[model samples]
Target: MHAIVIDDSSAMRMILKRIVTSLGFEATLAEHGRDALDKMDAADHRFDVALIDWIMPEMDGLEFIQAVRSDPRYDDVTLMMVSTESDQSKVVRALAAGAHEYLIKPFTPDAVAEKLELLGLLDPERVTAGV
Candidate 1:
């Protein structure tokens, strides 16, 4: 499967890329929401999931999620907010905005894998095999 890592922090992007790559997803990196959208448009294949951060310069994760949800072209992509925004209201707002999952920052790879598994992007067999 394919995935996108959207974050302003280069370290976070690389960390997320590594996690998703280990999960067998070929990932596209983006510095912010607008960059993510542009990369998505330029990509040859549709991504299965997007790991987004809340605070960004051009566009935030919420805006990106809204944009993706409003467009039918990205209907198949699962939106996951991986941000430091752990407020209950924000979490609910993200869900209302079409985020399939909200994984707070400072999470383990296992947490990400669990969220991806819940999204059905991670194959059960691969998890069982410890891939």
Candidate 2:
């Protein structure tokens, strides 16, 4: 699977890339929502999944998610909020805004693996599932 990981922090992007690689997926980087949109617009490749940070400089994750979900070109991709927001209302809002999943900050590689497994992107028989 191919993934677009959007975040303002290069360190966070690198960490996410390593975790995604562990699950056998190639990860593309986007510094913010605008960059992500540009990449998607310019590429022949469509992302299978998008891991978006909730907070960003130009466009936040919610706005970004809305933009992508509203576009026919990205309709088939799974949108996930990989963020630090853990408040119940925030989670609900993200889900309402078209996020397929939520991953709070400080997540481990195993956490990522389990979430992917639950979504059937990873082999459930090969990994232990958890929230």
Candidate 3:
């Protein structure tokens, strides 16, 4: 499986990339939504999931979700918002905007893994074996 981790913070991107890689995914990092899109378009790769941040320069995660949802090519890709925006309404907005999951920041790797499992992206065997 492959994942695109989009965030303005390099640290956050690295962290997310590490988490997904540990779960058996090839990870790609992006500085923002536009960069993510460009990177996706630049290759023939089909991402299995996208881990996005709500707030960003150029294009935010919400906009990224909308763009991806509108494009048929990304229909099979799961969208997950990994942001510090913990407001109820924000979570609702993200879900309503086509995100498959929303995970607040300051979260552990296990939290991310659990969300991926809930989204049916992670294998139960891997979770069970602590992969």
C-alpha TM-score for every candidate: 0.96, 0.93, 0.96
How far does residue 100 in candidate 2 sit from its true spot (Å)? 0.3
Q: Give the least accurate 10-residue stretch of model 2, judged by summed lDDT.
A: 122-131
Q: Cα lDDT for residue 24, model 2?
A: 80
- Predictions: Cα RMSD each: 1.1, 2.2, 0.9
Query: Model 2: per-residue lDDT, tens digit, 1-131?
Result: 89999999999999999888777888899999988999888878888888999999899899999999899989888888999988989999999999999999989888888877777788775465322
Which candidate, 2 or 3, has the higher TM-score?
3
- After best superposition, candidate 3 residue 113: deviation in angstroms? 0.8
In the range 59-94, model 3's lDDT, one tens digit per residue, is 999999999999998899999999999999999999
| Native-structure RMSD, model 1 | 1.1
Model 3 regions more than 4 Å off = none
lDDT (C-alpha, whole model) for all candidates: 0.93, 0.88, 0.93
Off by over 4 Å in 1: 128-131
Per-prediction backbone clash count: 0, 0, 0
